[model samples]
Target chain A: MKKLTTPLKVEDLKDLKAGDNVTITGYIYTARDAAHKRLVELLEEGKELPIDLEGAIIYYVGPTPAREGEPIGSAGPTTSYRMDSYTPQLLDQGLLGMIGKGKRSQEVKDKIVEKGAVYFAAIGGAAALIKKAIKSAEIVAYEDLGAEAIRKIYVEDFPVTVVNDAHGNDLYQSGRKEYLQWLKEN
Target chain B: MRQIDAGLITESVKKMVMEANYFLPEDVYSTIKEAQDKEEWQLASDILDKILQNADIAKNDQVPMCQDTGMAVVFVEMGQEVSIVNGYIEDAINQGIREGYEEGYLRKSVVGDPLNRVNTKDNTPGIIHYSIVPGDKLKITVAPKGFGSENMSRLKMLKPAEGLEGVKDFVLETVELAGPNPCPPIVVGVGIGGTMEKAAFLAKKSLMRSFDSYNENPFYADLEKELLEKINELGIGPQGFGGKTTALRVFIEYYPTHIAGLPVAVNIQCHAARHKEVVL
Candidate 1:
């Protein structure tokens, strides 16, 4: 396992490989389909974004509202493919990483390699356990969108596996291939 | 004839909604636990561990197991001998969802219109299926369905001649195409036979069955077992990391259909398979 602090630099991701477990600490932004649309639209309009994209990791999540005395409720990654269309533009804007579940389009994977970016996978249904790593969360944009609003969250030791790294390797592809090979041999 | 209060139904549904969201059903929890114990792959085992821990945290802390909280899907078995008083059952049920979402702090994930795409803000108007039975008591089952798996569901209308092989192929193909998106290890609910809509409905309904239960008919029960084996073979594994635990269970629910058509539907459900019920 490796440890990483956010606002990642290009070199910070240079050595990470697919299937490597890592724990991330620092601020990550939350956005899903609705917020991603607005962010891309803002970029198209040449308007400033509410949060900086430079060296920042985005988590594809829409956490439940926090209860009294809790930081956030059931925070976990949503499916990542829905954000594939908007991702290349974000990468161009210096978005360095994403944390979510599932596969990415080949175009997005190629873009990740081109932009020196990383895509991390958090266990999809493990929301309550993942919430423990979230120290604090506050809405950063599009509050009217409710759960789909963009929120900036501070996390400590948030566990994730490198799914797609800067080298263009995809864990979802390799892991299954390796397992199938092992099954055949054994 | 027996009379039942609609308000009582509302209260029960409200409680059921909260309970379903907060607690992982025992059948699902235990099956996951078993999967973890038997899993050989390190990564898959760890993923299963976290899922089990998440359930524990949700139950103890009284928080939702997943952030999606899901749009509530209710199944009603109304007793023919009972008359509901004070209000219509549908209104009562919607009222329950309204109050439960607010009080429980669950996310409101429903959209009022498909095209306009405005959040209903209350998660009202759940997809409800009602059936009339001969009993004097009302039975309600609250199943909160998260969209991750629901979006991956598929329905097919096959020619009668295509038969059993066609059904197996479609189910496998759906799971394969879904890949890691639906949060495997998933529960696959299959509905074979009936009309198109009925097949789809049956598939969704099969998801409500306990994981430990199999179809009553030996032929279908055997097919369910066979399908489960083939699905795990796809190596989707837990969270699609690849392993032997791709699916915890596969359920088949069937009804007689037109001789000309053989309809099949597959409803993929995430590991957080949550449902709770009450008799009134």
Candidate 2:
């Protein structure tokens, strides 16, 4: 239940360990498969990204529609593995964190260790709960992509678990392997 | 013949869509909560805690349960005695889905072409299955199916001699192949009998059943119990962290198949398992 309330800067990520549980507050950017493609292209061409990448956390989500009187609709994390191809590129640019579910590629893990970056997984399919932490949201870019459009979201104490760390440790595999071994023995 | 109003049907369907996306269904919520209480593995328990937290966040904030809100899948049961008053039943249902996705602020996930990959903005042209049964009411079950579990679904056709043992082996192997990728503590819907497609349909449709409810047929009920025990034996656990509850429940739906074939389909559902039922 470690709470992180302040707006995190890129340098602040140096303090986060691989297994530490964190609650991220302040402005984070939303990008899914499509947005990631565009962002990576921009980086390849040596062009500036739409937002400052340094110390920023990226959440992989598309979200359902919002009903009346709601700030955002069912907003939950998508699988992070889908974006593994583009993640290292972003990480190279000082991108400090990522939020989603499931495993990552070896290349991305290497980048996380090479750079002082962290990866966190918000609960999948808990969009409504995640939305409460979002104080405000605005489409930052790629409006034509419909739900896949890039948006910047502001939040207070958005919760996540560090699935991968700067040291290249992964919780998902370790957790699964331990259980499988235990099952074989018992 | 009894005539059903298209407008009224659209309205109810629209609400169902919104409800399915907005509120996490009670049975699913309770099951996850129950898993948290019963999970033996620490990692599994921790994953369950995160899922519960996700549920809380979605309910309190009106956010979606997952990012891949899923392509719109609707099962429509039309009474044999009924006819639509205004438009075709499929059109009306698609209209309701469009309205629901738009008004509810949910994701529009349908694509017009698979290879070319063009987005169908409204999430329209839903995957609608229509079946005519006894009475006059039209029933719709909306499932916001995420791709993670959907990707893991499998169907196999076996020689009639293969029997239940073959079915059991295939079902277990399917889950084993899926591993933690589909997100564990999966709800496995096993559909046996009928043609290849029907078995697959029954498998997907079986997922609509309540998590804890037993199948109506006694033999099938027993089968559900046995399969559930074996699935848990896999130790895939919560989110594949490994635990006693590899699967929360096993639901079986079967019909008489051709004597020559034993068709079986296993539709996997992650813990999120968002689905809703409505009658219009």
Candidate 3:
């Protein structure tokens, strides 16, 4: 398993491979459909973004309501593909990593290769399980958006698997192909 | 007719919300465990492990299973002989949802306007369906419908002559087209019959039944088994990584329909499958 820390760099993304387990630490940023829209709007306006994109990892999520005595509610990853349209734009601005469930679009994969970015797949539907990695979390911006608001999360050993590598390797494609072929033969 | 207090209905709903959102129903938990044991792929097994862990954390910590805690959805069965006092049953359910969501610190996922995209803020005004049955008690079940799987759900209106093969093909294609997106190893709910909307409603409602539960009709049960086998054959696997356990279960609910049309709705559910029930 790989350990990730904050202030991530392009070189930090180089060695990662599809299917490799990873434990991510440091300050991860949050985004979902609404947040993605706002981020794109900010980019279009040539304005500073809510968070820096350089060597940063964005988590696609919107958490549940927090009960008493908790930092956040079941905060599992949303599907990554929903943010496909806005990803390349952010990757162009130096976004190096993303964490969510499932696959990315071809265009997103191409950009990941060209920009040396990586996509990590977190366990979908495993919100509470994944949230345990988040030792501390606070809304950093966009509070009015509720769960979609951007939050800066301090994680410890946040487990994930590399789904799309900088080299454009996609596990979803390879993995599905392997099983489907086996199904046909048997 | 008997009178029932609105406050009681509200309390029942609140319990339903908390229980459904925070806990994994025992049947679902066991079903996942069974699937994990049966899953041959290491990656899929590990994913299933993490899902079990997620349910643990959500239950023990009183956290929601997913951050999207989903739009509050409830199915209610009321006895015709019984009557609610001081308020309409629908409004009481809305009130319960509001309180449960607020009290639980669950995300308010509902929006007031689809076009303007404004959040209702309290998660009130749940999508509630009620059926009047013979009994004195009101039975309700709450299922938090997440956007990921809900987005992938499909409804098709085919000519009656299309037959069973058409139904099976459509379902397989829906999941195939969904690919990795709906967080696979999904539970597919098939609603066949009635009008288009009824088919969709039954599909969602069928999901409320136990994952391991078989259709009462033997023929339908056989179809369920066959469908499950075929879906696993697709190799969509866990989270769409290749594997044998593409689906944990298939539940089909059908009603007699007009001779002209056969409507089938496929409602896909991720592994979370969080649901809870209360009767009073």
| TM-score, structure 1 vs. true | 0.99
Q: Model 1 over residues A17-111: C-alpha lDDT tens digits?
A: 99999999999999999999999999999999899999999999998879999888888899999999999999999999999999999999999
Ranking by lDDT: 1, 3, 2
Query: Rounded to one decimal, what is candidate 3's iRMSD?
Result: 1.5
CA shift at B223, candidate 1, in angstroms? Answer: 0.3
Instruction: Report how far residue B43 has shifted in candidate 3, in Å.
Output: 1.1
**Residue B201 of model 2, lDDT score:** 91
Worst 10 residues of 2 chain A by lDDT: A1-10
Preferred candidate (lDDT higher): 1 or 2: 1
Cα lDDT tens digits, model 1, B114-190, are: 98889999999898999999989999999999999999999999998889999999999999999999999999999
Candidate 1's chain A scores what TM-score? 0.98
lDDT, candidates in the order shown:
0.94, 0.79, 0.86
Worst 10 residues of 3 chain A by lDDT: A65-74
Question: Could you report the DockQ of all the candidates, in the order they appear?
Answer: 0.87, 0.45, 0.75
Q: Judge candidate 3 at residue B197 and give its lDDT.
A: 94
TM-score of 2: 0.86
Ranking by DockQ: 1, 3, 2
Tell how far residue B267 is off in model 1, in angstroms: 0.3
